[model samples]
Target chain A: MAVVLEVEGLKKKYGSLEALKGISFKVEEGEIFGLIGPNGAGKTTTLRIIATLLTPSDGKVTFLGFDLKKHPEKFREKISYLPEEAGAYRNMKGIDYLNFMAKFYAKDEAEVREFVERAKRICGLGERLKDKVGTYSKGMTRKLLLARALMTKPALAILDEPTSGLDVINSLEVREMIKGFTREGVSVLLSSHNMLEVEFLSDRVALIDRGEILDSGTPQGLKEKYQASNLEIVFRSAVQ
Target chain B: MKNFSHLLIKEIKELVNKQLVISLVFMLFIFNFIGNVTKSEIKKAMAKQKIAVLDLDKSEISKNIIGALNMANFIIEEKSGEKEQVVKELRSSGLDLLVVIPAGFGQEVSNFRPGEVETYSYLKGISMTGSRKSEIVKALLQTTNEFLSNEYLKKKLPDLDPKLLKAPIKSREFVVVRDRMAEGSTSAVIGSLYAQSFILPVILMMIIMYSSQMVITAIAMEKQNKTLETLLTVPISRTAVVMAKMLAAGIVGLLSAAIYMYGFRNAFSFNTGDIAKAMSGVAPILKQLGLTITTQGYALFGISLFLTILVALSLATILGVLAEDYRTAQSLTVPLVFLVLVPYFVSLFADINTMSLPAKILVLAIPFSHPFFAVQNIMFGHLNMLWLGIVYNFLFVVVMLYWTTKIFSTDRVLTMKLKWGKRKVVL
Candidate 1:
């Protein structure tokens, strides 16, 4: 399989504090690569850099052979970012919000309409899509945002804690949707604090702690290597 | 281009909502309603005034004096009885003025002794009507004195006209603007010009402040809602995003400016109806003295106004970027408001050129102050100053736009937040 994104020595700094300490990773096409860590483990910072939302202090990000630093707009055209605490324009109806996001990526009006229709099916909000987003429940809004993130059929979807605050049912639905998208040949770079969830969803998981990637492999392989029954045991043994 | 329009339309939709439209219409209705009511009241006050006259002598001169008062838009009420009785009655009679011609008043005038007419005026509250009544007393005394002086002159010296004897020397007033001179009352010309130009600084201040506020609020709301991050990552030019926001704010701010100016004109036109007519009368003299702004002058003023608004919007964009939430955005607008207020009051009260060096430089440092001075600078043929202001504003807007786009284009927009009473930094 072809590699869709390559992050080599990704380092980011804010004033004197080092957020990412020269970490390196690569995401292959049609795979879910999860960066798993606890709170304040630099998971969000790594995801943001790959999403082109922030420039790395000293690194190179090659997305589909285009240098992210030199051609951010080109990368932006092909990648979608779903921040952990993302929000839609509240005054806009859900369908309008989807349409607004689609137009930025679609080729023409027909494409925009097709994207909106796809988003409608993915979200499954039904007639409630006609109501303003401000009036929607949390689960409904999360589904709508998820649909937006995937509607454009981006080459790479960068999701930061996609199910961090969802209920069990909503979390299952989001995981199913993400899995369904990955099966269609979309590469995903996701970050999460839940090791079990990452073990369940990601094709390959990288254990990150204190701005460094301690270990990375298939969850089953890491569990076998650590002589443990679960990936959480693998993470604990690797961190120690 | 398409993305810019989409952003512009979405922004405008967010700002110009149903509630704002309804409130603006309601305010217009109220301003017009109050203006019409006060206008009619003023007309009624001008048409009629009531006064009491205690004609003690009951002579021809006293009757003639009462007739004179009657011709001057006053209703005469002749009172009789003791002096104290009439004087006390004046209080309850609801009359503001009373004249008491003492007994033997005609004998004193015939013997060439000065006639003493005791006048009683009731003190009332200091309303427009109450203050105007005191002016009437002065007019009353002038008319009575003129009539008595004419009578004395006609009897003592019958050969000369009283008008010519009263003013042997005539005074003519002329106003000179640069080289041109116009024959008119200097007061009338200055008053008319002041009336015409006084509202401009207010309008400019409002436009700048309103435009900046719209930008700040819109951006802050986006930040509060966390939509700004999603917007920044979208596949549009960062500069286009900044421009679209400022453009939308400009459209809404100018729309509000037009509506507010129309409402203000209607509200004040009723009270200053005569002033408008007088302005029209003085328009010719103003033109002769080169006090009117030309087409070129107006175009320059418009440019300055446009650039000034752009500068304010740019500053507000930076401020909004620094703000963490909606409430912080409102408090952040204080600097922009103060920038506008300083120039507003200065233009309204003092001449900018006559200000002290430090004060003048301070006022001119604020980009918004330029448009406030543009009208006068153009009217007075100070085209160089107006041109310099337009250029300076243009350059200022360019620099601010560049800086604003820089802030929006980078990660600084997300990470650079003003957190009060905290010392943690995150990336």
Candidate 2:
């Protein structure tokens, strides 16, 4: 397998506080790479840097052989990012919202329509897709947003806390959708606090805490390395 | 640039969602309707005056004077009740004036004595009608004096022409500006010109203020909802995003300007008609001296006005993105609003041509003040000043756009927060 993204010596600072300190990671082609950490553990900061939403204070990031800093627009063209608390324009219907976003990625009306159709099918909102997003339930909105992120079929999907603030059922559904991405040979870099989710969806995982990556390996490998039964236990032992 | 239209459409849809278009239409409709109603009432007031005349002389001269008054605005009601009764009715019936023609008044006029006509005018404390009624009294006295003068002059020179005795000399009034006699009412011409000078700036200020708020609210909403992050991550350049937002705001601002101008034109249309006719006669002379506004002048004004709005939108978008939510964003707009208002108020009284050096410098220093001068310059045909204003506004927009685009292209756009007192919040 080829590496789709490489991050070396990625560092970020917010005034005196270092959000990400010299973290390095990579995602292989068609692999689900998860960064598992606690709140404020720099998982989001790292993912944002990868998404090209933020510039690292000091780092070198290469996505598909393109220098992220020098060619961010080129990098951005091949990736889709979903923030933790992503929201739609409340006034727009779910279908309209998808179409609006689709226009940014698709080449023509036909492609935009095709993307919308695929997103609608993924969301499975049916009649609810025509309703304004402001009227949709939280779960429905999250599903729609996830569907939007997936519809573009980007080379890499950067999801920061994809299932944050979701119900158990919604979280499970999101995890399933992320798993489906791997089957399609799409690369994913996901960050989460839920060890179970990271273990379930990620082919390989990095245990990060306080802006540093403590460990990185296959989920089973990390569990075995920590002499733990599950990833929760592995995460606890790795952070300690 | 590929996603610019998409982003622009999204902004326009949001503005529609906010009911901005509907609100403007409703405002225009209601304002014009009210204006028409007020104009009709003013016409009615100007058409006539109601008065009660108490004629104690009971002579031919008194009766003739009453007849002359009746030919004009006076609706004469003969005094039959007591003075208190008439006075009481005066307040209720809206009678404008009460005339008490004293006894022996005709005999005193025959004896060449100055006979007094005591007039009691009922004036509402805050009403504009008081001065109008005073003018009516002055006219009435002048007419009565003329009748008395004609009687005296006829007897003094029975063979002479009455018109010649009435007016020994004929004089025609002309307004002299820079040693040239100018036609048209100086009051009306100057009044309308100054009126435009005052109102255009205020209108531009309001449009910029309102449209900037709309832009800020839109940007702040995207920031709060985290949608802007998703937007920036798209393939489009950051410059496209900033430009699209500014364009959308300018569109809304222009629409608002159109609505406001319609309302303003309608509200003042009745007054401007008379002024326009007065101005039309002298317009050629005014234009010869480059004192009248031309089509190009309006075009230039429009350009500078639009540029000023762009500058405002740029500032608003930056501040809005720097704010975490609407409350913070609105609070951030206060200083900008104050800056705009300072120019608006100053332009009302301060003439830039005669302004003190410090005051002129202060006015020129605030970029918001330039639009006010743009109006005055075009109307007065100060092309040099107008050109200077356009350049300054263009540079202002360029610098601000550069700053806004730089902000948009950075991580700071996502992390920037305003710090107040001991607390700091991400915008």
Interface RMSD of each: 1.1, 1.0
Which pairs clash inside model 2?
B322-B427, B323-B427, B324-B427
- Cα error, residue A194 of model 2, in Å, equals 1.6
- Report the Cα lDDT for residue B387, model 1: 87
Per-residue lDDT tens digits for candidate 2, residues B292-322, read 6678877897788777888898988888877
Label model 1 with its docking quality class. medium
lDDT of 2 by residue, A194-230 (tens): 9888889999999999999999999989888989998
Instruction: Tell the DockQ for candidate 2.
Output: 0.83
- Candidate 1 chain A: 10-residue stretch with minimal lDDT: A46-55
Superposition error at B69 for model 2 (Å) = 2.7
Find the candidate with the highest lDDT and give its number.
Answer: 1
